[model samples]
Target chain A: MDKLPVNHMQLDRLVLDWMAEVRTYILKEIQRPIIVNTKSNMRDLVTNLDQNVEKIYIEKIKQYDPNAQILSEEGFGDEITDLTGPVWIIDPIDGTMNFIKQRDEYASMLAYFYDGQAQGAWIMDVVKNEIVHGGPFQKVWLNQNLMEPPVERSLEQSLLSFSGIHLLYDHFQYQTMARAALGYRVYGSAGISFIRLLKGQLGGFTSVLKPWDFAAGLILCQALGLQVKTLDGQTVNVLSSNVILAAQSLVATDIKMLTNTSSNL
Target chain B: MDKLPVNHMQLDRLVLDWMAEVRTYILKEIQRPIIVNTKSNMRDLVTNLDQNVEKIYIEKIKQYDPNAQILSEEGFGDEITDLTGPVWIIDPIDGTMNFIKQRDEYASMLAYFYDGQAQGAWIMDVVKNEIVHGGPFQKVWLNQNLMEPPVERSLEQSLLSFSGIHLLYDHFQYQTMARAALGYRVYGSAGISFIRLLKGQLGGFTSVLKPWDFAAGLILCQALGLQVKTLDGQTVNVLSSNVILAAQSLVATDIKMLTNTSSNL
Candidate 1:
């Protein structure tokens, strides 16, 4: 392996510290009223906290690694066409609707990439105070404990999760795949859903997700020996939104067979 | 109103204490493996904790009010065809599938009825150590704090939840309702879903629920002045499973108009 410019261990520690600070800020801020606004549609919500958290991350990342390119949900970071250098991706509030309405089941996700490859990632269930973080080169950790690679389970014996909108709209035959699984669940947050997937609680998860939404989770899922790919069995482009499937290899294949499609999203 | 057989306050205290004990047991037992079995189908699951929790409630109910008719899931309680006496309804583990799979989002519920009238009801989010309890004669309480009644919102402005099966199978046009709402969520547990509803987090919730599943929630929802009824706008029978809807009155009416049905379930 080639030596990297920045110390990986030092960067990891710094990112973890940033995550802790962000978590504390969110916990205290949400106790009071928040400014909420919609993005593309009524269902796509963004909160003041989301912008604040993204700013915090961007500030910290620039302070530490000034040359790092950034891609973020709230658009607080740089806009580079390619990930040719150190890149930080952020989804300050992955399940903004849940945060604004249910006040739970939302997450903050961040991923570090160098030369278009994952270096480290973190997905924090802010309300639960649990963080699942790691990368392809390191063992995943849930909070302070080492997380085991999830055991592979057949689609028939595993619970599946889908974006509720996709399922309701019958996107890519999501309803059909849902019926084929042992059961279906919708948590509405890609980061939280990824936490469940990494914990072996979900057999598979399928949804149309943006870059920041899936970036952190994709790293953690890959570290856990899970397959992360597009519905058409292609590599997901981290710069664009895609209908993605993250699951055990066997379960992913089963879902593909059930859907039988080619890049529908 | 007529006087009840048992002192409501004292019984409430006793049940609260019992809930604490049950919560502790569940937290401990789930750390290790327990027996898992299926009930009506592969999706309908029951674990040892379910049976044990039901037995705990039954033994305590019998000890205090021996003549009380018990209607419970898991068959640990008495066989009762009518809610004519001092009746206790228990859903030991309301989201057994989630408990067995996700290890979260499940709840334990108990409701008391005197002469078919609700006296008190409790729904405990066991993992979170929070409980929502109260009845028609008393203000609803979420743990130590008094819970305010939920504010009414229109279907388009509120998040809706439904049974995953119903949504996937398009039962009663759940898909249409989902599209009409601000968003859709599926937590897969009636108790957890009811907790969200009572907290004013959800616009509405619709599901096919058995007696035990709806018993405790029905009381809490009614106490909060939210409407609880069948799809056909009939009173929900406390002794049988039915397709039930619980929501703000306006939201409920809106849903009924959308479905335009007459007791299909």
Candidate 2:
């Protein structure tokens, strides 16, 4: 396979077209009976739809650029150990629990990474029919409108979305962070929560998330000038479970202070 | 005014008609600049839209039935100490903070009571344009389709939504309940959260809510045979702030076991 030079406009069109196809396919399939399967635990869920959607993306990405590697939630993509070349990271259905139960709040996330650098990203909120896509080189687009960069807010001036279990256990001093922020919420889906954060509807979001869970959101956050990093301010490793604290820069700093002061990390 | 007889069909039509008008009025008002104001606290919000919408409801109800009384969030309606005669309970905009910030997750909630008995109830999720309305006699409708009674689940099998402050402070021992249930969530609006419960998308919801917050929600729960009460199993008073646990009977029973064992009321 030849090394294909990246073309921003062409990449946008191609990825959007693929996502549109995935959306139509899922919309039809969801109305029928969805075969649900449990993964990791009884509460951790996956559906046949997740597998089928990943298959579709894998086929398209391979055809679009044969040399491009793929890392995906389901095991339908490449087994590359290094980010030494063009790569596609995909979460076919980012909120499988919501998808299997409420049939809402789920999203399809896809992002392009090359030699450890994010190239582009897209998130299609399946139920709301909202698409947010962009990259570091492009302004983020929410549906058809270019999203204005969100106003930065102090930690005390923002609503924070957090994981319930983390707060209950006081992990990373989450309890203190909750009290210090304006208010707290938990919507049960990282993709939906990400949308709320990008819209400035939230101060920040802290959760233990997988690479696919943060892949597209991370790219979009970078494009919009929001901070994305490990809760401890370490660099994000794109292949493992990462404790992410994505927020406006000021809130991120405040949250870091709380976590740093906590006896337990 | 003159001891109006409870007419299920007529009330449904009138309430639906009024709701349609309310929806149109809000859709227009939302597009213009929204004027926000602080209520009891900075987080407890009210908007110009809330007052305007409540005013519209008050005017229409008065014109429709000259003698009917109203107890509303905005002081545009009468203040009655008791739920006697035809009384309309209205929360012009539930989740006003959401309406002001996110522009989603807010709802217009209305319920009718006569001689302290629920006659009809309606909740419109303004942004989603979905209405759930019915009464003790008529079947509940989400848009046009009648909602099937939600399947009952055991506490271990359901998702529970709780107010963040309640859980953080262990109000009602919500932390114990949080650990006892499958998991916990918070959408920040009682109406939106109630929709999830009625659909069986959630196992239960526990919060300290005002009359307007639970009026329509209480009626819908009764219509669907779900349990509505204080965590201590006291009857809900619809004229004041009260602690509420709205859930499937089996789940409610399970949650009661946890609450009963807690030292805090």
Name model 1 segments beyond 4 Å from true: A261-265, B261-265
All models: lDDT? 0.89, 0.87
lDDT for model 2: 0.87
Q: Please write out the lDDT profile of model 1 over residues B8-35, one tens digit for every residue.
A: 6677778999999999999999999979
Compared with the true structure, what per-residue lDDT tens digits does model 1 show for residues A138-180? 6798988999988888898889989988888887888788888
Per-residue C-alpha lDDT of model 2 across residues B1-265, encoded as one tens digit per residue: 3254866877788888888889899988888999888888878878889999999999998997899999999888997899778899999999876777677888999999988988889999888988889877787888788898898889988889898888887777888888887678878899998988888889899899999999999999889888899878999989989999999999999887776767655
Which candidate ranks first by lDDT, i.e. highest?
1
Q: Model 2: per-residue lDDT, tens digit, A1-265?
A: 3244577656887889999999999999999999988888877888899999999999999998899999999888888688888989999998777787678888999989889888899998998988889887767989878998788889988889987778877787788899888788887778888888998898799899988899888999989999899998988888788999999999999887766776555
- lDDT value for candidate 1? 0.89
Stretches of model 2 off by over 4 angstroms after superposition: A1-4, A261-265, B1-6, B261-265
- What's the TM for model 2? 0.95
Give the lDDT of residue A246 in candidate 1.
95
TM-score of 1: 0.96
DockQ of 2: 0.66
